[model samples]
Every structure is written in structure tokens, then in C-alpha cells.
Target: MTQQHLEPPVAAGLPTPVPGRAAKPSMRELILQAAAVLFYAQGIRAVSADKIITKVGITKVTFYRHFPGKDDLVVAYLERRAQSERDAIEGARRSSPGDPAGALRLIAEGIGVESCAPGFRGCPFINAAAEYADAGHPVREVVASHRRWFKATIEQILHEIGVADVSGVADQLVILRDGAMVGGHLGHRGDPQVVARSLVNAGRAVIEYSQAPD
Candidate 1:
């Protein structure tokens, strides 16, 4: 629910033009996405509205036309990151099709990679906090809601599959997931793909055990 995401549309009930609106950058969304890459790749504080305009090849006035100020830009970055995470999860679902284990495995593999932004930007939420240090910022909600939804989705899938101790399992998965991302960022010797697969195996065993009871 970052301010950017929560800000409601430019018009209450109206839809964004996307391809239908604006030119070059296309629309407000394109500007927001370009800014996210800059801010996440380099600390938010290190990037300025002027820099964003330069990178996007747009004038500061046009930037202002979309967002009132830099704070607004930061919120947009957070929302963009959350949307990326959501897309990853959705892609897993489409690729796996009812196979929760496969979906979980795909997520684990995604967390590990080289480079620093986009694929390996660490965590956008954590990066934003380092820049702003404001718990009350609109961006925090985007981070909070997305993370919460991920865990809840895991728990729901487990419940659907009749896994006993569903909540405990979901909590463990969340910890391992967040931990693996940090480990990858720090260059830890651990392979998240290996570790993630192991986690899925454990979940499979739990499913088998739960079924044995009945």
C-alpha cells in the first residue's frame, strides 16, 4: 500500500492510459519504472529527480507533471518493486499449474542470481528504508502488504493440500526465503536453489505424513 500504490488513480474511477497515454515514456508508470531501476540499483538518496529525468531523457517539468516531488517517486519505486514480486509469483503459478512444490521451487531459484538490480536488487523495501529511515513512509505499506500476501498465499496453498501444521510450515518457508535472499546478496557460500529444493522436499514429506493419519 505504498503511497504510490495507495494514491488511488489520477482520476478516482478512471483507468491509466498506459500505452494510450503520454508519449516516449508512455505514461506515469513508465516514468515510475525507470526511477525504480535507478533508485534500487543505486541508493535512493544517491539518485535525484534530475538524475531520473536525465536517465529517462525527460525534462524535470515533465517529471513534476506526473509526480509532485521526489517523495512521490520513492513511493512509486516501492509499488513497482511489489508489482514485480507479484509478477514472479504469478508466473510461477502459470508455469507450475496446481503443483505447489514446483511453484515454491521456482521462487527459490529466482531469489539467487548475480548482479545487483532487477533480478538481484536485494530487497527493494530494505533498500528504501536505508535511504529514508521513515517507518511511517507510504512505501513501507507496499513492502508490508506484499510480504504478508506472499506468506498468506503459501499458507493457503498448504491448507488446500491438507498439510498439517500449515502455519508453522509457512512461517518456516518465509524465514528461509528472506534468509536466502540476504545470503545471496552477501555472497554467502550457500546455494538457495539447493536449499530451496530441500525445503520443498520437507514439505512433501509433511504432506505424506499428514495423509497417513487418515
Candidate 2:
């Protein structure tokens, strides 16, 4: 019987890996990115984990490994959004140190820019709250937490501006912002400039009225 001979493996068959190639997003980040887009564009209830998994090119097991349930993913997405908003507001505050009105104007401008952006959706927290009606739900908790922080921030600004009743002013400011956001999304079909200027003017008006002597 003839002895059998084995050929050596060739390097040509293997594809060369590129060095310093940009790293792909982690499975978790990919999932969240997809969820954020879908959740914001469509209503939260309209989106499903399966849709997110498919968009992220992940399997159910892998998806669940990162997020045990859809709600967990939703919470994470909102948390990321919450942090981003906090950063923006904080940055605005920091931009005009010792100038409360300037800081508020910067914040209002930021909101106007966001409202006028392409594919602008109404406030994510408000949208999420609308979908999850139960105040006890985790989603609602996150919404509540972010809102409380926002109101407190506004109150701090008002206090700095010598507004004695910061609570009422803060509440009014929050309501005005909410209205502007909703109007920008639903009713304000005019120029983006107009929409943005309206928001800024409305916010300023509220503050001025509150500070006016009764």
C-alpha cells in the first residue's frame, strides 16, 4: 500500500485582517441605538424587541443576554437620553456662569434647535409617559426622575434671578416647554426660525410675567 501524503496549509486561502480598523459597536450599544431610533420615531408600544433584534442583527438570546427584557432595553435607552439631556442642560448652565437669564436663554435656544431639527419628535419623556400610563411603571419612574431634575434646575435658575416664588415659575416654565415641544411636533408647520423664536419669546414672557409686581 502506498503511503498517504498531506499537503501543508497555505496562507493564501485566508483573508488578511486589516490593522487599526475601527471597532464595531458592542452588541449592547447596537441594540440601544436601534431601539432609540425606533422608539422615538414610532410609539414605544408600536416597537418590539424582535424588530430591534433584527435591526441590530442580533439573536433573541444575545439580545436578552444584554437586556433581560424589552422593558430593560427601553429603560436603558431612556436613561441614555436622560443623561444626554442633563449634559446639555448642565453645559448650558456652565456656559453663562453667574448669569441665570443667559443660561436659560441658551437652554431655550438648544430646545428650539432640537425642535427644528430634521426628524424632530416631541419630548421623549413625554412620549414615553403617554405610552406607559401607569405612574408606578419603571418607565414612568425614569420620566418622573428626569422631570424632577429639570424642574429643580429651572428653579435654581429662577432663584438666581431673584424670583421669590421659584416653584410656581419653574412649573410654568416646564409647562411652556412642554407646550412648545408638542406644538413644534404637531402644529407648528411654519418656518423653523419662527418656531424657535416663538419658544424663546414664550419662555421669556413667562419669566417676565412672573417677576412683574402683582
Candidate 3:
């Protein structure tokens, strides 16, 4: 497991408050952060609101003030994760302006790095989707929304790369990424870096295949 997993959940990234010095996190952020850690480590359904309240050292009143219900907290947790992912992908694009392939490579590398991290447990979206089987559920909506954005992003990149019929290719690339994440977490696919390279290569192959003459 990663060092963060080994540490106390509530203390994962909390700063040591100095005497009259460090700025304290707002009660909302503190509660949300605690819930994010637990929800990611343990399944969302497995971690309860009371557990989050206890971990944050807050009363039911305070917890409810920030999040009206467990679903509220779960949605917030997923939205936070989704924002982080969006930022990462945008950053990759910015880092490789006008170069779709380079941005794609950076994206693969980022996923690879996450897989190699200790306590990696595959994709957060996938995990959440598994627990939330209802199509109309809020959590599933969040997952579906994020996935739509991701697939559209890939489709845009492929279009820029001169690949025709990118719809199927984009789907293939996303599936390849999903497999790579799981493979990296399972550690049964040889070295972690190899798994990452395979993702990049597989992505490129899909793009190239779509670009080929009929």
C-alpha cells in the first residue's frame, strides 16, 4: 500500500498546526477531504456518514451543515475527483500545444504513474460505477458525465491527428486506458512502466488503424 494509505485517514495531508500560525482548513473542506480519502480507500457504500463524522471529529450537526445527506457527500467526493482529472488532461494539452500525440502520451504517462503509486485500486470512476448500479442514480450520473467528457476529449484529439471515423477509435483508446489502469493495479502485466508503455502503444495503434486507407 502507498504511504498515504498506511497513515491515519484523517491525518493524510493535514498540516501540523503551529501555535497561532498555520491557517486551518474550513470545516467543509476538512469533512470533504476526509470523506474523499475514505471513499477512495474503502468502497463508497462501505464508508458511512457516521464514519466520516467520527474521522473528522465533528458532530452530526456540523457534518449535516456541510452535507445534507450521504448522497450529497458522495456526489461531492466524485465531483472533486472529476475536477482533478479534467485539470490533469487540460494540463497535458497545454503542455503539448498543437501536438495531439504528445498530449496523448502525457496522458498515458500520468495514468501509468498513478498505477505505480502504492495502494492503487484501478479507476475511481469504474469503482464508483460498480457500487452504483442504478442508471438514474446521482453517483452514476456523475460517472457518466465525466466519461462523456473524457471520450469527447479523446475524439477531439484523434480528429486533430487526421484520423477519420474517430468515434470507434476513441472508444478503443478509452478501453485500452481502462485495461492499462487495471493491469497496472493488478501488477500481473510485468513491470509497471511496461504497462504504461503498452497503453501508449495501444493508443497509437488504434489511431493509426483508423487513419489507414480502406
Candidate 4:
């Protein structure tokens, strides 16, 4: 007797399987991509697993198979954002090797460009944290971790630039960055270039002030 392997039933609107292999995205990737867009465009709390399933054309079974629940998916979404940020910062550092100020400027310029883009929303981590107020939640942990990394990165840069108060300067720069992101999304009065220039100038002043002779 031959063993029969039964394939899962395909839902309507979802891609049908081919004889050999299906030319479709992996269920996990599809869920993550769809959720990322929805969470960013529409707040995280506003987007539900059912909505994601509808958007991705996947069944509940598929979503659950990839993620245990909504919280799991949210964590994955944050992790993706964190990885992207780390990569961008690393690229800036590599592009301006040994020039901490230049690297910082690159990051600020990138943020400004993103803030001015069409359909621009505020920072993903900030948005997520607002919705998931529980600091102990996985989503909040990811946000906090990213923030810590960002602050530490700035401190290191300030220290390299010979700043006297690395900790204070880093804190000021982080605050300025948060403000820029909020202003870019809400204010929208000035050109993105103007916003970018202002951020760079402010960051530079922080470093300069720290370096000034007391």
C-alpha cells in the first residue's frame, strides 16, 4: 500500500499550488510584510490578525502556523524595524569611517528624507510603544532595546568627537532626534532639507558645546 500525503486545502483568493512548487511568498514573509505596512500606516493596535489575513489572502490557519498570536506578530514586526535601523546606522558608519560627526549627519539626513516621504508616518517604535503601553510587553521591550542601542551609539560617537559630557550630549541628541521625527510628521511647514539641516546643526552644536573649554 502506498502512503498518501494530503495537502492542506487552499482558500479562495490565495495562490493555488503548482504541481512541483508554488510560485508564492512563504506564509511567514507574507504575514510580516503585510503586517508591517498596516502597522506603520494604521497604528499597531488598529490592525488585527484577521485584517492581516484578509490583506495577505491567507487563512487563519496559515497565520497561526507562522505566528502563535497577535503579540508574536507584533514582536516580529518590531524586530524587523530594529534590524533595518541597525543596518542603516552601520552603513552610515562605514560610509564615513572614523568621522563620527559625519556619520551622525548621515543618520539625521536619512530620517529627514523618510519624514518627508509620501504617506509618511511617525517612528514605528514610537507608534508601537504608544499603543502597547505595558512596558513589560514584548513589543515595548523591543522598543526600549532599540532606544537604548540608539542612545549608546550616540554616546560613543560623542565620546569619539572628544565631547566632555558624552552622556548629556547623547541624551540631548536623542531628544532632538525624537523631536525632529515628530515635527516632520506633524508640522510639515518646512522643506525636508530644512528639517534635515536644522537637525544636523543642532547635533553639531551639542558636540561643540561639550568640546568647549570650561
Candidate 5:
């Protein structure tokens, strides 16, 4: 019998001898990922490329090799997140299998997960914007585009559900999601899923009430 081991994807892309990290990620990927975590955890201005290289356990040269600079890495990180959000929302829609309301509930519930993080810091985009509010950095533009897409997707779902005010439902859900993220970040120690469930329930109640025959 022959046994096989697999070399990772990034392994074929970069020089060996770099240590740590799970996948032996390429310099560009490493820089993107480190920026993702640090900027997500501590805001972009608060974290630097130096910190990313140090956290990645890679040389400064390795950092520069992948990303021209931190701004480039920031854009890459948000691009990755934008892709992920699209995938997750698409997955949630599939999970409900023709029930947009169910999918919306699932989406909200996941975002407010109490165990997701300590000091959660809300959405990565919101956190980054708080830091670069004046700079209009690459990160800000990426975040802005992502938020628009997300809200639009939610609106599409509401429209499919026959809601009269699709935009209103989407905007309301966005507020609930963001508010729960902040609540979970601050005073809430209990299961954020409970708060998440309540958000969905409230929306459902409004839908039912509006549709009730007079």
C-alpha cells in the first residue's frame, strides 16, 4: 500500500524556511491574513505591517514581497472578507431552502454569536472606519462596498418574501445586527443567540402584523 501526504497550496508559491502559521501561506496571503486578523481585532491604524510580519513570524522582506504596503494589504483583507460575506449569505439562503425569512434569521443569529469573540469589536469594517474615519483609506472603500452589497442582498431577500418595504426591512435588520454586535461587545455576557433570536422574532412579528387581515 502507498500512502500520500499533501503539500499545501501556498507551499508551491513561496520559498520554504518560513516558520509558524497553519498552511505555510504565501507572502501575499500571509500579509493579507495577518492584516485581516489584526485589523479586525485592533483597528487598521492601531496595527501596522510591522505587527503583521511579527505576528506572522515572517521577515519584513517577506511582508513587502507580498504587499506593496499596508494599504494594499488592507484592501486585500477586506476583499477577502467581502468574498466571504457573499459566500456566507448565499449559504444561509440555501440553508433555508426557499424560505427567505428563515435565512435572514440564520444570518442575524450567526453575526451575534456570543462566543465569536471577546470584546468582539463589532464588524471589522466598522472598527476600521472608526480608526480611518478621516483618511478615507483603501480599507474604508472596501468596507463601504461590502456594506452596500450586504444590505442589498438582504433587501433582495425581503423582496422575494413579498415585503412591501424591502429596503426598510433590510435597513432595520442591518441596524439590529450592528446593535447586537455592539451589545455583545459591551454588557452582554449571555448567549448572543438569544438576542439574535429576538431580533428575528421582532421582524417576524412586524411581518405577521402587517399581513393580518383587517
Candidate 6:
């Protein structure tokens, strides 16, 4: 997705300490919050340490004190994003206790809904992977770890639902999800309801296919 289409950085209008209040944000928190926004809104390579420092209104020394380098900050950014995704999935699962397929539907529905949000960009993990080409890079490692967790989570869900080919179905579902995110960002011709319905249908097909008798 184009930069213009992406959501504005979260750092904008960040809270400042009020007079006579002991609730000032720590230097580390400021740096992380700002970096997360900039990295997600702008490309990671495009955001330099100086830019982050300026955004956080901190000195170079303080920035380094929190993150020794840009790579560290990038890793932190992905970790934060990963945690958010995990929480979202967990929330969906909790909402439909004992119903794996229903939980998966909730997640698929979330992806469709999120894609339509104003200033929606594509998947952050995919975007980060594009920026960091080296598989050995710390940023790529973070992406890989997240992907592994995600795929495993999907597999576990399918397994719980008694899918015969859990691994294959999980892989197919991941492909569908990634495509939906990209297609939605590109304004592919469907309304959110249509998109969500399509996702649920495709996911149901996979589960049902596995249930078919040989």
C-alpha cells in the first residue's frame, strides 16, 4: 500500500507531562511508542535514529540508553505488533469457547473489518519482511518467529476441530488471510461484508474438505 494510504503515526499528539504531576512517561516508553508508530507508518529503513529521537523529543544519548541501535528498536516494534496480534486472536478464541471453527471465523472477520478501517495499510509483518530482505537479519527473525506462532496457532485450531490435514489447511488459511489483507488495502472491489463472507466461506470449505470421507 502507498504511504499516503497508511494510518498516521501514533506518535502524533503524544501526551506530555502536566505541571506538578509525577506521571511523566519514561524515556524508554517514549522512544518505543514513537519508534513503533514511525516504523509502521513509514518504512523501517526510512526512519533513522535521529528521526525517532526528534519525534520522542529526546537526546541521542537517551535514545541509545533505551535501544542500543536501530535494529533493537525494529525488533521491539515487531514484538509489540506480534503481541497485539496474539491478543486479538486470543480474544476471538475466548469469545467462542470450545468452538474452534467459530473462533477462526471471528479472526477472519476481524481481518476483514480491520482492512476497511480508515488509513488501513497491509499486514505489518509482511511489510516488515519486505523491508528486511536478509533472513538472518534480526527484523526478519522477529517476523519469522511471529509467522511460526501464527501458523502453529492456526494448525492447533484446525486440529482441535478434527481436521485430517491440519498442517495443509493451516497453510492454506494463512495464504487466504495474507491475500485478503493485501487485496483489501489495494481496494479490491468488495464491501466489508462481502469480504468477510468470502473469508468465512473459504475457511469453512477447508474445514469441511478435511471432514469429507475418503
Best by TM-score: 3
In model 6, the runs with Cα more than 4 Å from the true position are: 1-24
Q: What is the TM-score of each candidate against the true structure?
A: 0.72, 0.86, 0.88, 0.86, 0.80, 0.86
Local error of candidate 2 at 146, Å? 0.4
Q: Which ranges in model 4 have alpha carbons more than 4 Å from their true place?
A: 1-24, 187-189
Model 4 lDDT tens row, 100-173: 88998998988777777666677888878889879998999999999999899888877777787888989999
Candidate 6 contains a number of clashing pairs equal to: 0
Q: Give every collision pair in model 4.
A: none
What residue pairs are clashing in model 2?
A: none
Instruction: Rate residue 92 of model 1 by lDDT.
Output: 77
Q: For model 2, what is the error of residue 115's alpha carbon versus the real structure, in angstroms, after optimal superposition? A: 1.5
Q: What is the alpha-carbon lDDT of model 6 when measured against the actual structure?
A: 0.81
Per-residue lDDT of model 6, residues 31-61, tens digit only: 7778777876777889999999998788999
Per residue, candidate 1 scores C-alpha lDDT tens digits across 158-209 of 7766677777778777776666556545655545456556655655665566
Candidate 2 lDDT score at position 3: 7
lDDT minimum window of 10 residues, candidate 2: 1-10
Backbone Cα, N, C clashes tallied per candidate = 1, 0, 0, 0, 0, 0
C-alpha positional error of residue 209 in candidate 6 after TM-score superposition, expressed in Å: 2.2
Give the clashing residue pairs of candidate 3, or none: none
Q: Write the per-residue lDDT of candidate 3 for residues 1-214, one digit (tens) a residue.
A: 1222422223335567678876467677788778878888887999999999999899999999889999999998788778878978999999999999999999988887777776777788888999998989999999999999999999898888888887899899889888866775576445557766877988888887777778
Q: Supply candidate 1's per-residue lDDT for 22.
A: 40
Worst 10 residues of 6 by lDDT: 1-10
Q: How well does candidate 4 score on lDDT at residue 37?
A: 80
Using lDDT as the measure, name the better of candidate 1 and candidate 4.
4
**Superposed Cα deviation of residue 44, candidate 6 (Å):** 0.8
